[model samples]
Target: MTESQFFTPHDLPARWRRKRAFTFVDTTFSAFLALWQRWHDDENRCDRLHVVALAHLPALDTPPPADDPSPLAAELARAWPMRVPGTQRLEFDAGRVVLTLAIGDDIETLLSRLWLRADAFHLDLTATADPRKLCKTLARFAGDDATVCAFTADKQQLERALQASGFACTPRDAYTDAPVTARFAPRWRVRRHEPPLPCEANAREAIVIGAGLAGCAVSSRLAGRGWRVTLIDRHALPARDASGNPAGVFHPIVWRDDSVAARLTRAGFLYALRRWHALESAHHDLQRTGAGLLQIADTSDDAKALAHAIARFAYPPAYVQPMTRDEASRMAGVDVERGGWFFPLGGAISPAAVCAAQLADASANITPRMNTDVTRIAHDGRVWRAFDASGAEIASAPVLVLASAHDAARLAGLHGEPTRSVRGQLSVLDPCALDALRLPVIGEGYAVPLGQDGVLIGATYDIDDADGEIRADGHRENIERVAGMLPALANTSPGIRAGRVAFRCVTSDRMPMIGQFADENAARLNARELSGAWPLDLPRMPGLYGAFAFGSRGLVWATLAAELIASQIEGEPWPVERELAESVDPARFLLRLLRHGEFCAA
Candidate 1:
């Protein structure tokens, strides 16, 4: 059956239309595309329409034909996702419409992993092996009054499955082949935790601490959703910490197996590219390179293995291609010793420019409070208030986000000191140095062409080292590392000692904390009862969130981190998968402590 026959525009309820955001789930691609087209064409649609499409097959290699008559199809085809496992969120209609493609081989497994309050469901009976299991999973995400419409030949089986899963199935009017419809009017509790709902805010205002990429990105996302943000920073301007670096490389990590970190990085890298494109479309100069970035393998054998893995995974050349030694040399414009995978879209970007552009995008809704250090934060059950070193209240809002890097844990009163400071020293080469370096290359170290600023290279990772000085030896270290990748740099010297030193915040697990903070006090009070509690089971501080500890991947992780935090605040469909989001949850450290019986309650 066609998608139009299973569901149509008339099926959308008035209540969902009035909401700030509504989520729609579809098991088939054609139906998802139809829903996307309907929402895109509707002039009086809700503030945001989130369409989650579950696919058991890989994404199409080619997009829709340019001559396709449907504008929606053409636009969606342009943003078609890569053939990667995990969720890929594509935004259209200037961010009003979001399509989350959940790609995997198992439909039930994919549905179970997703976390969203779906307002509507379009199921494909032929796609699922077991309709009962699929319906049970669907009940977990269904919102109040949620509606479901499906076309099935075995109507009795579908109706029984829907009824058993708590949906009140509507009887067909004497038609055996007609589509079945149902509403989420469950008689008993179907889920342990209630499905997500819009955050109850007294006002649409928030206080964002720090002004780096994390803070700026959060403020911009929240402001875009019509929130008034008071942006506070210790520096006189944004991106003055580690984000103050001249340039940073952006790319996704490809491992032999798709690890959690790899998936999270892929999501961040892709989302950052989309956001950067949007910013550039608005005339924002991100100082981004389009020539792509080259990563060198440790050895020739490892390079061959990675290339084999790339082919085995069938990664698109547009995303990443295995590069031969000669090809790597041609791309870098210099002779290289090793060959590795090349990210066609990966390159260097100015973090400060990105932060500036994000802040500029939300300028109308942001009130910048520069040179104000938030030493403490307090929540009074309703609003969160920030204070300065002088004990003066700096800003207060219904919602507060701590994006202050190393200072975030302290400000939020998190127990365990979940983050540590790492001092990194970067060296900037003269324009004449590394003249043959045409694009960014990373391995032991990284080198990027900064136009008139010359080649940007080197980042000495010194853990637990607080000494923030640009030393001559640090420049030597950077030169030697990059020289290993590009043999031409062997003759280069630390002639000018031109570099900058900044501190980076990182967790022991090397993952950034991105979501809402768990209420440590409350959790400790019931430590025994909560020891086995999941992330969602942990009590969260009202109106308080965090987006910090992004060590070196701030350029890539910051924007997606911001979107995740913003989605948490607005209760919108998450930009990443549920498991991926939990990996970066700020409460992860605290949850670990609780689980291990290591946390001591006060």
Candidate 2:
């Protein structure tokens, strides 16, 4: 069920021809996992699979039944680690098998919020509410030539319900679990959503600007996909911006309601862990801190609220759990002041090292064209050519990626988009402060134990500040904030006067701007025609993309944003839902204007 067996060349329905198939399952998921394991073992099959399970309410507290080494229920129990509310994606077989389990939430609730096309559906009658209702839910997402396999004792009645919901019934005598199945041939035509049309040619050459975290990530993904990359940068080396920080912490932002930002951050954080692990196995020097991070909720109320959220979501102790002040003290080796939730996976890494590793890994397919400041980008009907200050062509390719932080929009001729520059200064203190500071803790600010570099602190978010020179005031603010939180770091201040300064590019919503840059002038001229347009409907500049506006979350946002761009370019099933993808869409501003009836008038 998790594999692409249902939608292959011979078995594929007409509507989903030549595309990766999305299969929906409504059941206990033990059967689905068995099918997934089978699909993973096959060597000849390569069809991509996206399996979404609108699970029937599970026995949330029930432990796995006593069994031997290999049982269907036991296998599922081991695989389905996060059984909390909302969506939890479990990837196996190296991303070939994606099982999205929507725990505690029903299929209809998820359908209302998500955008997906299900070409195949398997409904276990014992698991679903009503056969008719389940059929209706399938009709909403099923493609024109859909197929539904229903396992039920009352085959005749189930067939009638499916037929009423627009599927033509077929009852077979010799069937395994599902005695009856239905192939869709609706009498009434349904309005189906068409995906964004891929460009005429699947271009394999790309020119990426900026060699920072975002740029290196994009370049590496493209190179892995066999795309020849020309990595360009104005600076002599990469990671010279905010990514130049000695060490920055990585953790998902948690919210009571699990806001879009929080959800995306969780996805990003998980993907980054997978990516970092692979990088380290390949011998990349990440210099990561795997001892976990403690997000100190210094105030009693803050701690209580955080604890409530940790239990509310049923987040596993392995992922995140609340700890007492005493427990935290022991974990940090020497800490006293705050109790908070600890993310066992959250840790810090040198950004420059990660960037260098990505470039080195992609060295075979990536060509460096450094010290080339791209002043302007021009698309001559086919290829996008970048020009230097003296009007010399730096590099040109069919695809152009702008990952140059604040300069991303300017280089792509999208200066109208809002991107604020904030000056940040990080103070590096001597090893004297290292006595009690064990891990990174965020309160008024962050306190990072930078090992040999000593304790790194201070980052004043000075908005609209373009000056990149380090300041004593920034260092003073950093030291005061950390001392206020840890107290033990108070004496480490005099040595913290030395630090580094970098400007960060952040968006109003605090989400990174990703995806294709919309042709705003074209959108303005044809505003009336696109008045109620969605993101995919917006006219975009072909071959021009962005992965900037990461703000202070480059570590968390890097791999996911890179994967999103790669998926879009390859026309693969998106790693994110449509709503999540739209939340970070570069065309969001243009769509906002059109929605408010301002684009046409402007």
Candidate 3:
């Protein structure tokens, strides 16, 4: 059916006006784009419109016709995504309208994987294998009063399917070819779990611990959503911990196959770019490099395999390109290593600048309480309160977020101390030390050109070592590792007396903890009944969230982490897939312990 036939101008606006935020699911790209264009044109639209599109093919590669009259189509053409088999989120109308494109070969499998409360559905029945099965899957995501418009030649079969799936089909009109319409009004329960609802809070107030990248990112996101945030930190200013590094690199991971880490990194990398661009548009100087970054493979054979994989996957040149040794050397201005891939959008940025920009963006709604050490936190049923060394209350709110890196698990009172601290020491070289170097080059070790601030290099990852002093051996190790990639650095003298030491929080699996904390006390009380419970089955602490243990990927993971947490607090659709969110759930460790029957009654 045509777009207009499915959703007329008269009917679309009336439906949009009924809700503050609307979610629409489409199985075809053409329908998705058409609806999105219509939403863009509606001036009196809802506050937010989320459109989830599932496609068996990748995004369009060709740009829209230059002579085309539709500005929305042209805009979408410019923001087209790479040919990757995963979810890619695109924002429009200053982030008020979002399109989550799920690209994969199997539409049925893709639909089964998604987890969202869909308000409306635009289904192309011709694309699915079984209409009844599809209807059943759709019922799982349908919210109260959900509506569906389906295009199908077999109206009787479609009506039957919808009726069986708990949707009350409307009587057919005189036109036989018209689409079928239905409303979700089941006589019996159609789902095992209830649909997600908005979070119940007394007020739009929150207390976020730690003022680094994670904390500041959360604060900015919540504030942007009209939440008044209380940001507390032990240090006098933001980004004074792991995020205090002179500069850090940001890029997506590419393995032979699309692994979980690779997909998560890709999402975070893309989201970070958009957020950073927004910051720069607002005149915030992130001290970010425009030039691309080069990666040196450990072996030529490894580089060849990766290049083949890149070709097989058909990655766009704008995202990544395989580079020969000579090509890499030219890109880096000075590189002596094996062939590897180059990330055009990847480069180093000052972590401090990023944190400051985020905090500045939300200055109006953020209250920073600096130089205050939160000894512990306690929740009195409705509100969570922070206390200092002398047991004085530092801050309290109905919503609390722990973004204190290594201290997050400890503060949350999780068993087994699932996170560890890694001491990283970095060395800053003189300006003329590496004149041959131009852009950032990373592999075994990274070398970033900081312009007048000199070249930044070296980060020795010593696990569980808390020595805060900068040692001479750490500098030597940094120089040696970087010299392996940049040959010119090998001849430089060991006069690098300038360096800094900082600790990083990391988990054993390397994935960060990001989401609401599980109710350990409740779970322990019912341990026997919850042994085989899934991540979602575990009861969560009311209004308590976590966004820490990012390890070395803070620059890439922080922004996305914050978005996920804010979405959870507001009970909005998650920014990433449900499986991806579960991978980083703060209670994943606890869930594991429960599965292994490791808990004893208190």
Better of 1 and 2 by lDDT: 1
**lDDT (C-alpha) at residue 57 in model 1:** 58
**Best-to-worst TM-score order:** 1, 3, 2
| lDDT tens digits by residue: candidate 2, 1-602 | 43343333215333333444445454455445545655555554445556766654454455455563556447456654444455555655555556766556565565444445566666657544557766665665666566776667677777877888778876566545534677778797533454333344456899999899999999988887677999999888988888888888899876667888888888788778767876897899998987889877758678788889888877778778897888877887666477877888898898999999989988999999888798999998899999999999888898899999989878776635678898998888876654566777776788787767677887899999877788888888887887766767676545752688888898888888888889888899888878899887888898888999999899999888987787677654456667888999988877887887786635
Candidate 1 clashing pairs, residues 3+ apart or interchain: none
Q: Rate the local accuracy (lDDT) of all candidates.
A: 0.86, 0.74, 0.85
Model 1 regions more than 4 Å off = 1-10, 13-15, 40-44, 57-59, 65-67, 173-175, 431-433, 491-494, 600-602
Q: Tens digits of per-residue lDDT for model 3 on 157-241? A: 8889899989999897846777788989999988777656666789999999999999999999899888899999999999999
TM-score leader: 1
Question: By lDDT, is 2 or 3 better?
Answer: 3
Query: Residue 432 lDDT in model 2?
Result: 67
Model 1 residue-pair collision total? 0
Query: Any residue pairs clashing in model 3, and if so which?
Result: none
Output the lDDT of residue 6, model 2: 39
